[model samples]
Target: MELPLDSPADQLLLAGDQVLLVGSSYGGRPLAASRGTAPGGDAVGRIAPGPEVPKLVLRTVDISDPAAPHITATLEVEGAAVDTRVVGGIARVVVRSQPASLDFVYPSGPSSEQRAAEINRQIVEDSTIDHWLPSYALEAGGQQSAGRTVACDQVHRPASFSGFSLLSVLTVDLAAGLSAGAGAGVLADGQRVYASPENLYVALDRYEDVPVPETAAPETIPATTVPTPTAAPPASTAIHKFSITGAEPAAYLASGTVDGLLLNDFSMSEHEGVLRVATTVGAGRWGNAVADDGAPVSESFVTTFAQDGEQLAQLGQVGGLGLGEQIFGVRFLGAVGYVVTFRQTDPLYTIDLADPANPAVRGELEILGYSAYLHPLGDGRLLGVGQDATAEGVRTGAQVSLFDVADPADPQRLSQLTLPDGWTSAEHDRHAFLWWAAAGLAVLPVEGATVSADGSAVAPFSGVVGIGVEGDQLAERGRFGHPAQDPTCPPGPEPRLVPSDDGGPEAAAVPAPPATALPTTVAPSPALGGDEAGAGTSSVGGGSSSGVAPAVVDSPWCQPFEPPISRSLVIGEVLYTLSDAGLQANDLQSLATLGWAPFA
Candidate 1:
């Protein structure tokens, strides 16, 4: 699954307090076409994967001992890990695959477009069901399976047409030591997934009145096969609901349509017997022809639906919020909803959903910066994570805001902590954020570096930033760095938290280590970005030139091979983070590095 802007995460599932599953899951742009062998070659005439493409690698870990967690099993599946969900102790992994006919040299290229289309159709019709579905290999109990396929029934064509791509939902029982559980398949494409305790929803963008170019969409709907929307203006989205209630495979329950496209999992929420989704309507697909007056064309909306017979019928909707901007953050908490949109500034709008059929915008508050993620802090308060921008809307760096929504119609900004010139994955990836209520700490993966005017990094650092929240105030509890991937290129400097020039409160630094101090990391290295101030530095691909650089680079920044910590968990008094390098545990309260272990 390939997508831009949004990076689908490799999920880490923590089962109770003993285990964690980390790898591909959630949001993708279907499958991409890769080059194969020559005509009538291995892949051209058969169902073979691209030579350069590898199957999704999943690791099942035992975290019972946080300080020394170990991998219990590894499963490799042939496809992109689309998503995963755990309920009633069983985990469901969704994967999408498109066995391509790469390197299909049609005897010095096909004669014409029609001829190329004909050849492709033949390849599809001749392929069997197993070839289109996901196949997996599991290694556990000191044994490895040669391979296994996601079993399902005959591939039936959808009446509306959804191409011949394969998407599978595989069940896995972690307690059973990484066994590939009962699996099922559907011939559809959707990047977003929303799940309730009893239901799983897949939302596919719909191109109703939009005119898609012939090259972007399939030449024809296909007599019975072809892909869905490849590139088109989505006027709405079709929701396909599947039941994950019992032992049987995820059974399709119903279907419905909602105006505009969904933002993320937060875009849809299932309450009582209704489903509410927030989206940006009128997403311009007609490239040049936007609003005639050069105004913001797309608008934000909250629409509600309820299952009536076999369809999710639309009931009510509220629109006209954030005239021209898209949603930055969306959170539906029971009968209330919060949507954040940004352009020149941030507008945090509150929605009243007490009456599902009459959802309306209750109140709104405008601020200088916008929040990308929102977390409930109990007692009518919300924690927002995003960038602190200038009055002109230029993002300075990372910003943390505590909002008092006690009065929904009149929300207030309780406190603000703005960091000038650093970046954090937690801004876009929710999986990278952890809120431990018991300890009153919010931790997210952050990377800070002193970038010179010429664009070279002075001392780049990466790790987690702990934010202490109580009532309406926010404090920087501590900043921790990761073990260097290369001793030669050490994480530039340990980052220290500082206050902004705007007279904001200074961060209470992590106390100096005493003789009794738990094993910890290096000292603080200030993250300096021009005149703005930020907290700690971080890395997706630890210290890589690009946050998640795909290759090696000989630069000023640390080119450490160690992958930076990306996901975290709070077990008892210890905070554990995971990365390709290994696992590290920290003393929860003081953010003292307690222990670090390398993987096998």
Candidate 2:
């Protein structure tokens, strides 16, 4: 059963037997007249306003019956939803609201004629100082029957400055079917957002130019001496923390702005009451070539901050990490943090955060390429998904690295897999990569060209690659993709025989083309069988010398012509892969199709 709504769902989350869907709806003129307003101006002459303001809608669905989900309830709120996260029965959503439009009142009636002229005169005569003041002032007239009028200060101003927008956080209780505004804050706009079960962090970038000092030089300066120009300070990152606990909803707890800019939301992590931020300072903002200091600068640093009352106070900082390089990945686990910075080479740095007041870099390992996303594999091992690079730092394709960090002071890359001309969504979005510790399996959406025996790249395929991690070794289990279908070409006109130019006997009529059969559906290639020794039998470290060989599967379904895989997750022994086309469930062990749910 398909249940259609007014708007397409943009995001969804499942909790128990319920699914929450959030979408946007749009309708009315943005600058329409208020209720009971008299239309005096030339209504016909004015241009029509644009589409109505956008509103966010939340729909709750009961999915007890997996085959036929039904909408249980819905709630609407003004503004567009930016980001949302659901923890248990609580849903935290961030919405951005902008003023409809800026409109000024025009005078009407006989007595108001003279007042209108005076208002125009004041607006034209106001100086710069007065222009900075409020545009209008409200005053009360008479005692018995009070009347209010607004005195205009400026006749015109930019629409953007005339009104202000708001960034609001709202909390919704799915079980109680109630929602309330948690808190409101000011931001020029919103960017990437990060949230945990108990805290929400918003990263905002800030730029400020250091003022150059004015000085007078001496009358006779030495010809051999040259004065150097002062450098400007680097950009800063302001992280605002909000507490999302309690029945009252979330509220801003504190904000800490440090010198540098974070790569993105993934560069921040909070653990053990301390927030660790990995940022690249000295690097100009928005990809500017040079910093405000007027020099090419690049330096990575990690700072630790702790909550102090209602504000976050900086405890300590470690700098000079991967100097001249930018940060690529950051992961915080317990009292340890891993940072990947790269330019010509990838430098994976391990920072000890156990002492927040004095955080220090414990170890550093230099590798050929960099990891854009880092995941902890428990027991002091880290999994990295990024790109492979040459000695000259030329990125070739996607690569996965397994690191042994049991000894923080001596981190080593246990094993690395290089997929030539290949890429994975996990490099940019960590959620795309799934790891099952118990099963010793990691699945990643891999797309790339396969090299043939003749050293030619062929048979490009898009699908999930299952890598089995046993102890310190890595083995390729198999690959799975959607089914394929033969191509279809439009029918052409029937062939007709033509006489020769010499006017000789006409050439025999071109034989009618043989009737062709309809194109047949092609089943997807089967997954490679596991090695007889065991699953993930490839040895990447000292454990097993006989490594399991990778399996090759050829299927047209792996081409880009098919829907791209967007997300993947594992539940029990079933692996679920979602794409624009639909959801596909596969057996975790063999990568065989189990079920499918097509989008309606």
Candidate 3:
């Protein structure tokens, strides 16, 4: 039964007989607020459901053997429940109600469906949820780094249509510092629409507001008169993307295997004239061949790809022969035009494309069990991640590793330091392990990582880590689920791998160990910053521009890793996910998609 609330309830908790709560399964948590309409006026409220059962259908199971088998009560509810269905294991709860006095806001009492529809509409219309232009810099020669400056008339409008989010993208081609022209189109569900070459730039949000030609009442806005586009301040432009994964394939033996989107996920980024992609590939049904196979005994390789909206190239791979997957984590190390891949276990690889047509593995380094993320130091080194393990089977813990790849082929593992751990709030542990078997590893670089007050420090690019890597070595760095943070870590006296779905008898419970987070501050050193070299040309969006000084673009942030439903391929800047569902191109940067083209 649907519980009456401000709108559609994201989660429902029914107590007394059998308690159950439903919510978002991502990060094992629910959204902050799920708006809905009660039988009254308009309203907004935080998502919360108290221990009150509106309705319950009970069922009984007849059985014997008190310890092994027994009869238990069960209740089933109707309608759409929270995506999450966890019993007594609930962690935190939050609830909010719309002020009664605010009822005036809605003259027409919206139905529950209407409220849900409106809420969805608002989500889709929010084009600037967090949009911004990155900072850029100028350089000699008409040629410049793709991220050097923002297009004078470039505009990005992320809107929602249907259940999908659509980005009405427009960019202006600038010759020197002036507009060459404008092009525009919609980017929705793997599709891209753009303007012609002569009309290099297409104004976004602006085009959305253009009044439609008169025809009594226009159903949609016209293709003109959109508000003049505004530039996204540097500070407002923060980087967010995946850089690593957990559970190394190398750690697994012939019979060992792991299935996790935690590390080695695929991602993409754009360079001066090419687009790049990076991803992981471990054991699936035929992931890697056994040692004695007569054939090539093909090994699974995690690779990244790059292209120019058409042709593609494989730029990097990791864990080629080892049990772990390769290219688990990938990042576009600015300036050198290299894509860095964090290994599932040790020795990270950097694919340098100084020669775009013939991109080669330029750097390598030996470190810990796996790399959660990697940030370019800009000069020539990288800020890498070393993860700790968690009780839930996830290798947790965070570490900062510096690598000197002045010579990409001979990258050196410089220093590794485990960061001090702690939860963001008093209510949280030193480090919040939200997912089962999920060891969090997202690095937030401070200082030297440049950006204007607006947050757009677009430049030669440096200082940032994404997520994912291996599990074999994570144990050495730190234990997962230290009892200090979670008493449940150690189960009674012994430890055993618990089935991710259910805790069975064969599974021995082990004692929990102590876990911690890394320090946010660190001393600035040559290893932290790449070798002192020319900053190189940088652009805010893409292509050439003037009036900007060369700077380093910080790495993007690590958002939650949402495993796609198919096999994915990353080569250079191009990403291809081969799923029964089809193939598409993914943006490596903000992860905001550009478009997708189908193939046979």
Candidate 4:
């Protein structure tokens, strides 16, 4: 009879003149009681497992007081009990089991035999348990349990130290029986014993000499200054072909993570075949300080190509109040570049980028709230679109702010428009759950408007809730929004008193290339007047003081800031956008100024 070890566990029993330790991983112990009867004492036991792995524990009890024979607990080590001795008139039974080691990152499952063996080996080679530390006590379940130290066979263990240390002593009381889950440890004077969840001990100091691997960080390139170009004749115009699809390539250019800075908005522009992007950066860092005076301050950098995708240049990266931080939006007012930031008190900043590389502060208009997108109306003017607080204190959607930049140095707000009643401002407010720097409304140019050759006027630019003339006072034209085509909604309100031709702007749609083929090999353009041909202009005449471009200038289509030395050419008076994935050319020969072809 194998004693049915695999069956559900049962409490151990000590018959008269017999000490039977059941579930002892061995045959129950049979020690004759002093008076030829079982001890009338109680015992306790407890076992806790690992978080990701399962383990086991066992404890015994003696409460019958069968003649009150001194109870002795023994744990076999390799089937051999060593150093069974008595200290201070009490039997100190200490068994040295192997160290308990566990795999920190284990799969979701039970522990393997190999893992348990390893843990046992570590414990045996590295741990030391004191015999006097072993004790037995009774538990609530009225079962026998054994623990680390003896507590004069009386008193309860303090709850504060419970479950904290592997060493515990149960002060056995004259209870009826031992209790289950009663664990204890004996703290013998030693410093190297590493406590483990399975009640096994190991020496951490021994493993301190083990070498661990180090982690490596990803590489990053820093920003540098742009090089000066030499004077040369304007390059020849070439017909650069582009796929009609307006999809942008997914390849990442220069990228870095800026913690604590929520990106308010971002836009991309092209100069000299290099992609220059402006992003409004800010966040909780700004608290109301008297010195702040209700002004927005921060730092921003312009990322652009230096050479053939190998190097990058950073410009307009200044740090100060109302300079770098105040910039709200960055857009190309025509060919001229401009940055829109805000002040603490006022809510608008119109920066003139007559110089693309170096931007100069033009006008700072104090709007009620903040601007979401800035659309260039060409020639020192821009259409700022966002929401404003209504009299009811609600934010209406798409409040249009028209401005006149007749003087790039002093941009004034022409007018402000608000959303109609019934619409809520909460829709525009930020949600705490969503990341502040995620996606928002993208301000795309209205196709064909004033920049198209046919100049179709059937676009969304027909309404003007507000308009700010160069020298005129800002006036509220009327409220307006996209008219619904659904017949259910009685023709939407037409708020513009003097609506411009809606069919003015037109975009040339390109035909998609035939499928089942790889990208076609494009022919390089003819030699230019050398690198000097790379000269770029912020305006038609020259670059501005900022070394970039004027934000108010207009370009019929996307044009490169300057010419680049590449077999890839974009020419004619068409606008061309280039990146690592290649180029996209928009034909804008009809726009007032700022139009160019690819491969020129």
Candidate 5:
């Protein structure tokens, strides 16, 4: 099934008769009338099209008629939809945003800093809790909702100040629709999300503000040097857990704090009523902490948590797993766990999680490259998909390795395949990788762009690559991609979408070319922690903020991805590949093309 989604989707969910699409950040006029709290604490009766005000779009399409799928409902919310999970008959979406409608004076340098700061503080103090919660408008069937604000009673706040970003987890009943759902807020910022059938977890890094002495003038403060207490602060992660076991609204169960930051949702798992977490500490978010001699000093650890009333308390922790290295992958399988850390060589450590109170490393395997994502391949084998690097840590391309983990004490790489210059969407999104155990097939979206020695031209290709999971090896069976657009243009930088004159969205720019893409031999992956972009001035009146931007910045990949395949699925004997460009179906056995449907 295929339907046009103006904005890029961060994730997709398939329900019985509907396909749900959600984009973290969108910049267009509301697809339908919007009634929500505007970014600046004002009531937005109807939101207009503009890039200035960030928006999250959630559209549900009725796919009952495969040949002509259409959007039946849309909820345009004032915030970024971080991630979502569907349980039984309800979908819970986590959105991170803040009230930006308040107009505070922008400081005129150090002289006006204190005054602006004070003005912002007053505005925040005077504002109600509704100003900090996400607002939304729902349009379904021919009915519209005048949504209510997230009640103060439903929101959870941290003991210390945790920035201005408010995280809201909204629930929508799949069968009952959005009218019967509600949302709750957590007074903290979050990015990575992990969910099981029973619970969902959101993990985000906490920033420490260096306080200036009340006696010191703004101009007298040192710009680069720390005043005092400059010991390297341990990077911390705040996790919020919610129960999704019932069809009722998602209930905020507990919240906890860890001493490190997570790589992604994979860094968290729930088993036997306990939550296991993995993170990298002693680094500044991105694991770039360095010693006086310019060596990496970051370390990783695994922690366990159990519910204690309304709080999640730490139970046990195993640290020093990868000294001077950061975590690349994590997966907790039942009573066992796997952690991958990489610097020059990849160290795969298997942990014993049977005893939640005493987790320990049982065995380790060192390999040349690292796996950013891992999947269990039946019985006792693990499949890894990530960049293949040389002994010097220079990444060559994407590699797929099968490991024998049946023997936890002695893990070994059974077979491997490396594509010299390839990149896959699966490295960052596990949803993009499909494991069909019944057919012994593993499918993923992969691309490789080969530039001429002079770098003037390139051959760029992207498609669904099917790898046969034979007895002990992984070999490529076949690959296929969508038909190229007429008179193809070379790929360069991915075009960013901006608000159009009519309130619709359009690409800011497109790569001009002689029909070739410009992707580099090595794919770019922002390890663990990410860069926080500085916010430029907003419309004059908006008050002061810390380090948060209106929306999160994109990754560091420079080359433009012209509709890279993002997901693949198997239905009986047909394999379906999906991307922004369209959806394609091929024979599950012979890689023969069956059909292609472009989104309208």
Candidate 6:
């Protein structure tokens, strides 16, 4: 059931009968509170004056009854919630807050030019390092005021300062119903967080524009003869580690800067007290020229760090991976790490992190397209969901690849299935993909379009496709759309594949056979003990124990306003899918809908 609140819900966690919802609430600032300087000076320029304050509200909801859920308690604090994680009986949330005086305050009676000068002066005054650094006082007219200030001693600071972004972690005890103090540290803005059972890692990408100083040439010299200044290098990422098990979250254990940017949250992994980070470095912003002075260039690196008490000690680093390419995906399985980087070709690099002090690349396999999301299949196999592309790196459509990495030195793609005119949600959000190991089944939300014989594109169809994995091969169980389409019927003809142009040595390693068209129809395969007659098709309200099929509906090719399929999870013999529409449960074996609950 839906528990409506005044603010927009940012995150939610369900533990037993207790539900925690974090929402962002915006309200006008008090008149008296608008005159002071914010914790960090107004480096965030050109905005409204005295903007509304954003407060994060944590609402505890009791969900004992499935039909009704009510709010139990709430704790409000200043900031916008970024992410939340629940473990045991405690919940940790990451919030970002700004100073109340972050906006500009102009003098009441000044000319336009004078007002501009005053604003610039205020900006310069606010841009001081004192404002950017934590622990600064929030004051106006030399008077102490009640305002938000981040404790500097609690956070790790960079050697140089830039603009300001304050990050706070809030800890809540669900059992005790207590709110801990704002987290133990401050961080630069726009950070992605990754957590382990014992520690948390925060990564921040920092970029500073290098000002080009003008040259004063002799009057005889031509203006065109002046050489332009070289562009600055690519941005860097600073990673900080914090301990989670303390009265208050411990301060940053250790911090280090990597010479690159992380692709996303999947780029980091912590295993057995060691942290491995994969990043794409040296790709200068805006296609800037790279210096040829033996400096680093566009490449990916897998760096390893070992935890020592309160510090993360850099063990070893392996660089120069996928030269001239950007990292698309990274996954770590114990001591082995897989990295996918793409430009003209996809290079799947296998990195061995068993020896953290001397990490090395174990293998490199070049393919036509890259994988944006990678999932382990429990054996030596990996399931990759991403776009298929030609040898020139032109992405075509959604593709699923089964890779066998049993031999790290020679990983092989055992099977590949592609839909020429479709995209799957799993590519960008791994949570949309579900794996049922017992049934050897994998399901993902897919949407595709087709061009009829008249050369006109037919409306696209959205559904969930079930893939059955047996040994080294992949089989399409069937596609189940909403509104319960014909299950015994067949799908339309498969889309055509684009031929590759590359015929290099790497491309010759495992030559792909001619593409095969998928069968139009699939036979009904009931659950282990389900009846075959009850498996034809069923909708949300009507379905048999065997399975309930999804409904089929036509949609536009570019559906910008389409509600997304947010989450998919499998429990026991049932599969649950959550979307804006509501929650749906399907039989894991028959791929049929069992029940659905709409938002109340």
Best by TM-score: 5
lDDT of each: 0.66, 0.64, 0.29, 0.30, 0.71, 0.65
Q: Write candidate 4's Cα lDDT for 17-101 as tens digits.
A: 4332322233222332221111221111112223222112223334346445433332212111211222222222222221123
User: What digit string (tens of lDDT, one per residue) describes model 6 on residues 1-600?
Assistant: 456688877777777887777787777654443343322221122444244667777777778897898776666666667676565567777766654454554432112335545665777577754444223222223343333334556655544442356666667776544343445655455468887777777777877544323243233345355334354455888776767774455455766667788888888888888888997776655433234563435778988888665455678999879876788888989999999988767889899998988899999888888898999997799998888899877988778899999999999999987766778878877768888888998888877624221334544535566788988998776554433222233343445444446744332233343333322223343333344432432322111211222233232221122234567788777776766755666777766656555453
Clashes of 6: 8
lDDT, residue 546, model 3 = 16
Name the candidate that leads on lDDT. Answer: 5
Candidate 3 colliding pairs, count:
115
Q: By TM-score, rank the candidates, best first.
A: 5, 6, 2, 1, 3, 4
lDDT of 1 by residue, 187-259 (tens): 7666677778888877776666433245532333343553343333557776766777764566556667777
Question: What is the TM-score of candidate 4?
Answer: 0.28
Q: How big is the positional error of residue 67 in model 6, measured in Å on the Cα after superposition?
A: 3.3
Q: Model 2: per-residue lDDT, tens digit, 450-567? A: 6321345546646667788877877666665543322343343477777877789876466554443443333322233222222221212112111112222233322224345778
Better of 3 and 5 by lDDT: 5
Superposition error at 388 for model 4 (Å): 3.1
Query: Candidates' TM-scores?
Result: 0.69, 0.70, 0.29, 0.28, 0.75, 0.73
For candidate 5, the TM-score is: 0.75
TM-score of 6: 0.73
lDDT per residue for candidate 3 within 392-445, as digits (tens), equals 324333454566777867877665544333111101121211111133232222
In candidate 5, what are the lDDT values of residues 1-600, reduced to their tens digit? Answer: 446567777666777877777875555433444443323232324322344567778788777888999888888788887878777767888888766554444442334455556666787688875666667788889988855436567787765555577788888766554453667777878888888889988888875644556566545555565655333455788888888778767777778888878888889999999999998886664346457676657888999999998688999999878777788988889989999998878999999989999999999999998998999977999999998889988998888899999989999999997666788878897888999988999988768734221233334545666788899977777655654432233354555566666776554554332334332322121211222111111111112111112222233333343456788888888787777766766667876556555565
**RMSD from true fold, candidate 2:** 13.0
